[model samples]
Target: MTTTIRSVETFRLRVPRDNGAPTERFRAAPRVRSIYPTADELLLVRIATDDHVGWGEALAPASPEAPGALIDEVFAPFLVGVDIAAGARPLTRRLQQTGRERGHLSGIQADAIAAVDIALWDLFGQVTALPVKTLLGGANVDAVPVYMSEVNGASAHAKAATAALLYERGMERFKVHLVGPPEIALAEYDVVRSEVGTSRLALDAHWVHGAGDARRLARGLDERGAWFLEAPLAPEDVDGHVRLAAYSGTSIAIGEAMRHRFEFAQWAGAGAMAIAQPDLGRTGITEAISIATIMGAHHIPLAPHHSMASGIAYAAALHVSAAVDDLLAVEWGPRIAERSDSFLDVAFLEPIGTSGAWIEGGVVAVPAGAGLGIHVDEEAVRRLAAG
Candidate 1:
């Protein structure tokens, strides 16, 4: 039976916890910025078909409230009662068309559609009784490597301590976010590089520097054997990224800010990006796949972003990562995940434990079963939903 979308509901989940864990880690290193929120709220999109249910999440860091309203006000009205079993392609095209006409093709508009599109795909997978990885053909790797992302800290010593903890836990790949002068960032990088023992390292400057500084920072890290220099320039400056990527020969990772594949094509075609990090909460599964396919043609690896999302989106990313050929590693947010009010559980292959993301091994396995391959507690989601 072809399933029609019955309803679309967005639940805002916020849970209470110490939230100060990461902050305390940065207590001595005062210059480090906090990218992960304390007491973060996630907007979960739930789409129910005649019989099956599907789940999705919007990337609402800092607990932005606009995407949920956009879903209720705009996306739901258009998606409800639509037979999505044919695939979410047409509807997504229509939604983007509508957004273009209304001048909201990016930002919140894109985010709302992203969540809706993910739910639609989850519904499709459930109907077929196959994991999404299988639905997207088959996985290229059995388990994708995981990368721990966090504020590397204020001082070099502080940075080294954090790296030491993660390294002891078996995490070899890391993306460290550092703020302040390029020199300060380099200092922390040097200490971490020394402590981590020839491990893979990437730096995210959080758009704190420009092409010149990014060039300098890239050179410093390159000389020291860093994997990639990420987001040194602001996300909108594609040309700047292109120049840096070309000049430094260091693969630049971008795409968390990008909403669709067309944007990624612009970056990849320009040779601006070496790795693409589209957030599933922003591009969702449909466009994330499309973007990955575009990047794959360019031989760019996909390292899907996962800053502050809950477990639902993480599970979704695992399936997509497992399906792709050139996959680096999914960014893990132990800081955010600890208190993000993510509520989902399902029996999965323990090829890796802990939501298929084994922190100890720095590798995450694809969750098995149908749809998004997790059981969501909708009732708990509603209760946890913030006002």
Candidate 2:
């Protein structure tokens, strides 16, 4: 049984959640509305050998077809027939170098590389009979603590109801995604706080604020004992983040837009954020670990962000989250699992415990198997791709 890349495939899927219901917060704050799509879109990659198959996904919230095409036209040719004996990291470096001449180490090109890198790691794990965590230097925690991301509803009372329901389901921490004036955000926060009755709330400003506005919001969050304030300023404003973090009592969180270690190194060096949130679907397993190392060196805790990506991305995040020692909490979208798990044969990650007896903690155990620890429905993926 020779171990070599036998086939490489890509799927672009767009699954609408709640019939593509419009996000109310985005409507209220149109400045950042374009940052997120109305539906969940994904770019999934499959790499197979003689006997085993591996799955990977990239964080393609919009225009996923671009990266899907990149995988087929650019990355697939280079990956097919390659030997998997040396494992994923060496191959990942080589693949990154292939695009270095084209200056394709960031953005959509890096995203395509991310999918291939993750699939290769999955293949490597199965071939070596080890979990991805072990390949990344073993797990430091038994389970990764998670914070429920976004308190959603139509109105303030509805938002409170949503928060209460999640609280009953064992979600102890939450982040409010509000992008506008600080007063509007604080009023919503107060509504949610009344329902959850906990000081473990966080906020995502959607990168819409200037330093002055971010400082005002941070003051409100600090008074409420927020777990963190995420993306307070523009993604490129490292200096602004450093300034805001310097004075804000609330921990500042950043890093979902970044794809490589170099960007993370700059932010880490500048002390731009109190928490580092590298998304595995964007950074891939190799670079996400590298970014984590950079964050660790600066004494910043890793909190890994999650949004509309599929279950493969979620599993990858869990593996990397477990491996990092200075972990805070992985961001968990409350209703994201419904669409994220739609195409999977078996759920790699799911809400633990049953209704009425839900576990009273917000921790997720790392999947317990080789090659990302989940099964992908290839037929379903093919059908979706064909459509």
* TM-scores for every candidate against the unseen true structure: 0.89, 0.94
RMSD of 1: 3.9
Residue-by-residue lDDT tens digits, candidate 1, 89-203: 6777787777776645578888888888788778888887878888888888767888878635657778788877877666788877776678878887887788787678888
- What C-alpha lDDT values do all the predictions have? 0.77, 0.83
Please report how far candidate 1 places residue 29 from its true position, in Å: 13
Candidate 1 lDDT score relative to the true structure: 0.77
Q: What are the clashing pairs of model 1?
A: none
Error of 2 at 258 (Å): 0.7
lDDT, residue 200, candidate 1: 89
Per-residue lDDT of candidate 2, residues 46-145 (tens digit): 9999988889999988778888898899788988999998899988888788778665669888888888888988888899888899988899875778
